[model samples]
Target: MVTVLIVDDHPSFRTSARRVLEDAGYQVIGEAHDGQSALAAARVLRPAVILLDVQLPDLDGFEVALQLTADEDAPAVVLTSSREGNEFGGLVAASRARGFLPKDEVSGPALAALLR
Candidate 1:
């Protein structure tokens, strides 16, 4: 199973996402509520993928993705948001993330496809 770190500001969403991914057989290794915490968690866990929220407390998800991908052994980043895909416009493409997913659509299978 792939390991993942879920980063989001909402406590309830994190709980829901963890349950969803876990049910689909992915191991949720850790979770962070903001970009700085996400970076710290990523360094320690070295998960295969990071389910990151677009809007964060400390830094935007794109900025976080950029920093994470700068590392030689960075994991795949799958950006997420409560807003629609078109809402972010070109910003998502500009990031180093593998893909973007609206929060409601996020799932283990969807994330797995992004990794592929």
Candidate 2:
């Protein structure tokens, strides 16, 4: 099973995502509400994937993705936003994130496809 870390500012989203991913057979190793904590948790937990939110309190998801991907054994970062994918344009393609997922479309199958 793939281990996952969920990073979002909203507690409800985090809780809901944990359920969805877990239900899909992914192991939810940890969660973070902001970019700083996300970074900290990623280091400690070392999950296989990171479901990262774009509009983080401390830093944006793109920024975080870049930082994480800089590491030699970086987890696969999948960027998520409440906004549509078109709004981000080339930002997602430019970042080191495996792909971008609209928050509403974040499901286990969708996330697994992105990792592929």
Candidate 3:
């Protein structure tokens, strides 16, 4: 099974995402509401994929992605955001994130596909 780490500030979003991914045959190993916790979870859990919110309290998704990517066994980071702008696009291009998705655009199958 693919282990997933969900990093989002909203409780509803995190619960919903966990249900969706779990239903789609993905194992949710950890969840974090802030970037700092996300990084800690990533280090401990070492999930296969990280569904991360770009606007985190402690650190931004790009910073977390950079730190994770520097690790020897970094997991793939999929940035999630509601923002739609050129600046976001540029950040994604420069970061270590594997992909970016709008918060509402994500579906269980799509997330599963990303893991695959």
Best by lDDT: 2
Evaluate all candidate structures by whole-model CA lDDT and list the values in order. Answer: 0.91, 0.92, 0.84
Candidate 2 local accuracy as lDDT? Answer: 0.92
Residue 15 C-alpha lDDT in model 2: 95
Could you estimate the TM-score for every candidate?
Answer: 0.96, 0.97, 0.90
lDDT of 3 by residue, 63-111 (tens): 8889878877789888888776255758987887787778887777777
Q: Write the per-residue lDDT of candidate 1 for residues 1-116, one digit (tens) a residue.
A: 88989999999999999999999999999999998999899999999989999899889788899998888788989899999978988999999889998999988788778889
Best by TM-score: 2
Candidate 2 lDDT, 12-96, residue by residue in tens: 9999999999999999999999999998999899999999998998897788889988888899999998999889889999998
Error of 3 at 107 (Å): 2.0
Error of 1 at 36 (Å): 0.9
